[model samples]
Every structure is written in structure tokens, then in C-alpha cells.
Target chain A: MTDIIVGILAFLGTIFVFLAAVGMVRMPDTYLRISVTTKAATLGIGLLLIAGAIYSNELAITAKILAIILFLLLTAPVSAHLIGRTSYFSGVKLWKNSVMDDMEGKYDTSSEELRSGFETDPEKSKPTKSSG
Target chain B: MVDRIIALDLIITTGIGFISAYSILYDQPALLDVAMILALIAFLGTVAFTYYIQQKNKQ
Candidate 1:
């Protein structure tokens, strides 16, 4: 029974990881590709890791598997964010076919004061007309 | 940048593929676990990085 279960999980995991690769290549944009691949890989690997843990029946190994799962969940988004933000700053062009400009609209017309979040709080930043 | 990242992915995947192949051949569950996890991590990290670069490019 355990062997069957392990085989099923391993097979499922392989399919998922393979899908991630396909998505990475097939998607037109970076974010979309990343989303597909990252999400798939996480679930796939997590399952496979757990399968391995179950097979090993070792508490330590299972814990490590769980740790890796948790770690992946936490860092995946952050790294993707970094890459996207950096690409934008360094001037990677947006997909011409993209319909919206959610990130750009904010920066396009934004003045320095607006950008700094002090547009309505000049008094708070002033040395005070009474003092300076 | 994609080139650099792809190069890295290829290298890591090659290394990991070797390790995974070894585990499968030798029937080492522990080694298999390690390979599977590392491969997953690399796959995710690269995909994520690619997204970020794209997002940044958009910005």
C-alpha cells in the first residue's frame, strides 16, 4: 500500500514539475511564467518531499521536508518581487499587449512630494516657520 | 540577464539531475529526496526571478 501511494505521489510530482518547465517556456511574459512555474513547483516538490518523508519514516527528514516547504512559500514571492522591481527600474519594457499599467500610472504623473508621501504633511516636515 | 539566469539553471539542473539519477539508480530514498527538493527549489527560484525581472522591466 505504501509503495503504491509513494509511486502515485512521485508520479504526480514529476508531472507537476514538468508542467512548470513547460509553462516557463510557453508563457509570453515573465510574471505569468514565474507564477505558473513557482506555484506548480512548490506544490509538486512539497508532495514529493512528503512522500519521501513517509517512505523514510524518519521524523527528522519529515521535519526538514516541512521546513523546505515553508521556506519556499515564504521566499518565492519575495524573490519574484525583487526580480520584477529590478527589471522595471533597469527599464525592461512592458508587454505591449498588456492592457493595463497599474504600476506605471502611479509613477508617471507623481511629483517628488507625492512620491515621498509628504504631499499633505509639509507642516510635519517643516522646521516650523516659527523656528526657522 | 536571462542568459545568466538560464546558465545558472542549466548548471544547477545538470548537477541535480546527476544526483537524482544516482539516487534513482541506487534506490537511495534520502538522495532522491535531496535531489527532488533541490530541483524544485531551483525551478521555483528561477521562475520567480524571471517574473521579477519582467515586472521590473514593466516598471
Candidate 2:
């Protein structure tokens, strides 16, 4: 029974990781690649770790596996965010077919700051300020 | 722009994860430590690469 469960988990984990790899290649832009790969890879890693823990059937190994899973879960998002931010700052262009860019013109490259969409238009804010 | 859409570190990390699981199934627990360290280094490597890219573009 344990073997069956472990095999199932390992298979599922492999499938997810494989999907991440495929997405990485198929995605058109850097941001899209990062977004797809990070979530899938992280989940795959967690599943693989869980399977390993079950297969080992040792308390110490299981604890270590859990720790690894926890660490990966915490850092995956942070690293992905860092990569995407850096790519944007480095002027990686978006997909040509991308419809709307929420961050367009909202990022102040000079100061390395990101402003809200509403805050980006001084003209829009000026009318409200004058009315108030 | 990088030639590849995805970063190399992500692929390496996934491979290490798979290897670690295989190691456990094969009755070699020691390899798990190595896999964990490799994964850690892969993540740090990605962060460092991004920082480098950011600094390069800052100019």
C-alpha cells in the first residue's frame, strides 16, 4: 500500500515538473515563463519530497524532507519575483500580443519605484486636487 | 535579452528534486543532503544572476 501511494505521488510529481519544463520552453515572454514555471516546479518539488519521505519511512529523513519542502515553498516565489523584476528592469520586451500591461509607465526606472496605475497620471490627480 | 525564455537554474533544480527522490527509493539517504544543498545553491544562483542582470541594466 505504501509503495503504491509513493509511486502515485512520484508519478504525479514528475508530470507536474515535466509540464513546467514544457511551459518554460513554450511561453512567449520572460514574465510568462517565470509565472508558469515557478508554480508548477514548486508544487512538483513538494510532491517529490513528500514521496521521498514516505518511501524512506524514517523520522529523521521525513523531517529533513519536510524542511526542504518548506524552504523551497518559501523561496520559490521570492526568487521568481526577483527574476521577473530584474527582467523588467533590464528591458525585456513583453509579448507583442499582450493586451494590457498593468505595469506600463507605472514603474519609475530612475528611482526604482513602482506607482499605482491611478497615481501615474498627474493630470488626473491634478483635477481632483483642484476640486478638493 | 537572454536567448532562453526560462532561466537555467529552474531546470537544474527540478532535475535535482527528481534525483533526490530516486536516491531515497534506491536506499541511499545520504544523497538527499547533497540534493538539498544543490537545490539551495540553484536558487541562490538564480538570485545572483538576476542581481547581475539588474546591475548591468542600471547603467
Candidate 3:
């Protein structure tokens, strides 16, 4: 029974990882590629780790697997966000067919700040001027 | 250029980590350590690359 569970999990994990690779190749732009791969790869590895933990059934191995899963889950989003932000700031263009860019005109290139799109009054959102 | 390179590096590192998970099937648990370290390196690498890009843009 345990063997069957492990096989199923490992199979699913492999499939997701494979799909992540395909998405990385097929996605239209850098941002789209990053978004797809990060989520898919993270989940794939996490499931694989869980399967390993179950198969091993050792205290040390299971704990290590848990730690790895936690680390992957926590870091994947952060890395994806960093990559996307850097790509955007460095002027990587969006796909031609992209309908709407929520980040459009929101980034202040001079100060490297992003103004809030939700705020109606732009001046009210600014930090108080430092000095004259 | 940098974006594509970094994204590709991330995916490849992830693939390597996934492969290391296979050690468990063969009853070699030590390789899990490799997977753990790879995860750390991938995150640090992304952070460093992003910082480099940001600084480059600031100049």
C-alpha cells in the first residue's frame, strides 16, 4: 500500500515538473515563464519530497524532507517576484498580445518607486517631502 | 538577456533538484542533502541576480 502511494506521488510530481519545463519553453514572455515555472516546479518538488519522506519512514529523513518542502514553498514566490520585478524594471517588453499591464506607468523610474494605482489622489500617497 | 538567463537557470536548478529526489527510490537518502542545498543556492542566486539588475538600472 505504501509503495503504491509513493509511486502515485512520484508520478504526479514528475508530470508537474515536466509541464513546468514545457511552460518555460512555450510561454510568450519572461514574466509569463517565471510565473508558470515557479508555481509548477515548487509544487512538483514538494510532492516528490513528501513521497520520499513517506517511503523512507525514518525520523531524520522525514524531518529533512519537511524542511526542504518548507524552504521550497517559501522561497519560490520570493524568487519569482524578484525576477519579475527586475525584468520589468530592466525594460523587458510585454508580449504584443498582452491586454492590460497593471504595472504600466505605476513605476517611477527616477526614484525606483511604484505608485499605488488604487489611490485616487496621487499627492496624498506620496511620502512627505523631506525638506526645502 | 539577464531575465531569460536567470529564469532558465532557475528551471534547470529545479530540474536537477527533482532528479536528486530519485535517490530516495534507490534507497540513498544522502542525496536529499544535495536537493536541500540546491534549493538554497537557487534562492540566493535569484536574489543576487535581481540585485545586480536593479543596481545596473539605477546607474
Candidate 4:
């Protein structure tokens, strides 16, 4: 029974990993590709780790597997965020068909800073400057 | 973009780690140490790469 279960988990994990690879290749742009692969590949490996723990059924091995999973879950999203931020700042163009871009006009390329998009009232600005 | 690439690299590393761990399970249990080391390397590699990219962008 354990063998069968392990085999099933391993198979599913391989399939998800394969799909992630395909998504990486097929996605239109860097951001889309990153989004797809990050989620899929992480899940794939997580499943594989679970399978490994079950197969071994030993305390040490299971503990190690859990640690790996924890590390992965913590780091994957952070790395993805940093990568996306870097790419955006570095001027990677969005897909032509992208529906919305909140960052548009808000990012200052020269300073590499994101600007607030909210409209500032001229009266408030004048009053603040005069008071100061 | 760099993040995605980093993630892809990590995913590949993880797959390799899985393979190594399976070998340890079936073949030489002594190779368990190899799997552990690989996990450490993968974690450190991601951190180092992210730092490199950030530093490069700052300049």
C-alpha cells in the first residue's frame, strides 16, 4: 500500500513539474511565466517531498523533508516578488494584451522609485507651502 | 524576471535533490548526507543570486 501511494505521488509530482516547464516555455512574457512556474513547480516538489517522507517512514528523513518544505515555502514567494520588482524596474515591457497596469506612469525610471498615483490638490499644496 | 529565472533554477535544483534522496532511499543510505548538502546549497544559492541582482540594479 505504501509503495502504491508513493508511486502515485511521485507520478503526480512529475506531471506538475512537467506542466510548469511547459508553462514557462509557453507563457507570453516574463511575468506570466514567472507566475505560472513558481506556483506549479513549488507544489510539484512539495508533493515529491511528501512522497519521500512516506516512503522512508523514518524520523530523521521526515524531519529533513519537512525542513526543506518549510524553507521552500518561505523563500519562493519572496524570490518571486524580488524578481518581479527587478524586472519592472529594469523596464521589461508588459504584454500588449495586458488588461491593466497600475504601475504605469507611477514608476520613475530615472530615480527607480514608484510614485504615488493619487491626485494632489493644488490648494492643499499651496497652503502647506505657505504655512511652512 | 530574474526572480522567475531564480525560481526555475531552484525548482531544477529541487528536482535533483529529490532524485538524490530517492537514490539514498533505494541504494546507498549513506548518500542521505548528499541530499542534505544539496538542500543547503539550493537555499544559499537563491539568496546569493537575489543579492547579486539587487546589487547590480542599485548600480
Interface CA RMSD of each prediction in angstroms: 5.2, 2.0, 1.8, 2.9
What is the clash tally of candidate 4?
1
Query: In candidate 2, what are the lDDT values of residues B1-59, reduced to their tens digit?
Result: 44242467666768777677778667887788877887788778777788777778777
TM-score of chain B of each: 0.73, 0.73, 0.72, 0.65
| Per-residue accuracy of model 4 over B1-59 as CA lDDT, tens digit each | 46456555646555654674475358444455565566567656666776777678678
Candidate 3 at B24: error in angstroms?
2.0
Off by over 4 Å in 2: A108-114, A117-132, B1-5
The alpha-carbon deviation from the true structure for residue A33 of candidate 1, after best TM-score superposition, in angstroms, is 1.9
Candidate 1's residue-wise lDDT over A2-120, tens digit each? 87887787678767777777777777775565467557766666666666666667787667657756765676566556655555445456656878645452232212121332456
Residue pairs in collision within model 1 = A83-B52, A83-B53, A84-B52, A84-B53, A84-B56, A87-B56, A87-B57, A88-B56, A88-B57, A92-B57
lDDT (tens digit, per residue) of candidate 3 on A6-124 = 98888888888888888887888888888778888887888888888898989998998899889888888888888887888788888889887877776766676776666778784
Q: Let me know the TM-score candidate 2 reaches against the reference structure.
A: 0.86
Q: What TM-score does each of the candidates earn? A: 0.64, 0.86, 0.85, 0.80
Give the best candidate by DockQ.
3
Candidate 4 residue lDDT tens string, A27-132: 8887897787778877887777788878888898788778767876876787677677767767777888999877776665555555454548553222111100
RMSD of 4: 5.8
Name the better of 2 and 4 by TM-score. Answer: 2
* Best prediction by lDDT: 3
Error of 4 at A102 (Å): 1.1
Which should have the higher TM-score, number 3 or number 4? 3
Interface RMSD (Å) of model 2? 2.0
